[model samples]
Target: MIVMNDSQYHQLVDDAFERIEQTMDSDDFDIECDINGGVLTLEFENRSKMVINKQEPLHQLWLATKFGGYHFEWHEAEQQWICNRSGNEFWSLLVESITKQSGEELSF
Candidate 1:
């Protein structure tokens, strides 16, 4: 595990969402991606949401969906953020979450 400092964690997440936004932006409807402080909120057309935020004290990223909550930590060797419990990569989880909530496939 790579324990990321607040600055590094923020930059990582900030860049991730920016890429996701660019890739997912479509003419049909926009997936609203907003960042306030350390929390990133993605809103689907159905008014459902997926929330992602940094846990500074734990050096982890936390995600909340309608189905469940998941926590991820930085993996330096893999150059990815992996779930603390499941080891699922952060981008995969986010894509799955969006697909489940919105019935659309997103790649990031």
Candidate 2:
């Protein structure tokens, strides 16, 4: 994993989620999001939810859904979050999780 200072890590995660939020806002997706204490909760119309949280100590981002939990590290070369185990893009994994849980296709 590329080493990032805490501020840079936080800023990148914040920016990524803000982009996701903007996508939901502009496209009218059924997902509602709330971020508190560095954790983002995304609630779907069907009532299922996905949560993304920051892990400052490890410099990782964690994603939790009904299926399981995922740990993502900054991939500097790719300029995106990549799952530590599966190597999936954060956006694609998140979309898959939301779709599977909510039965709604999400572009983000």
- Best prediction by lDDT: 2
Native-to-model Cα distance after best TM-score fit, residue 32 in candidate 1, in Å: 1.3
lDDT of 2 by residue, 69-92 (tens): 999999899998999999999999
Q: Give the root-mean-square deviation of each candidate in angstroms.
A: 1.9, 1.1
- Alpha carbon lDDT of each predicted model: 0.81, 0.88
lDDT, candidate 1, residue 41?
86
**Error of model 1, residue 107, in angstroms:** 0.5
Off by over 4 Å in 2: none
lDDT for residue 59 in candidate 1, whole number 0-100: 76
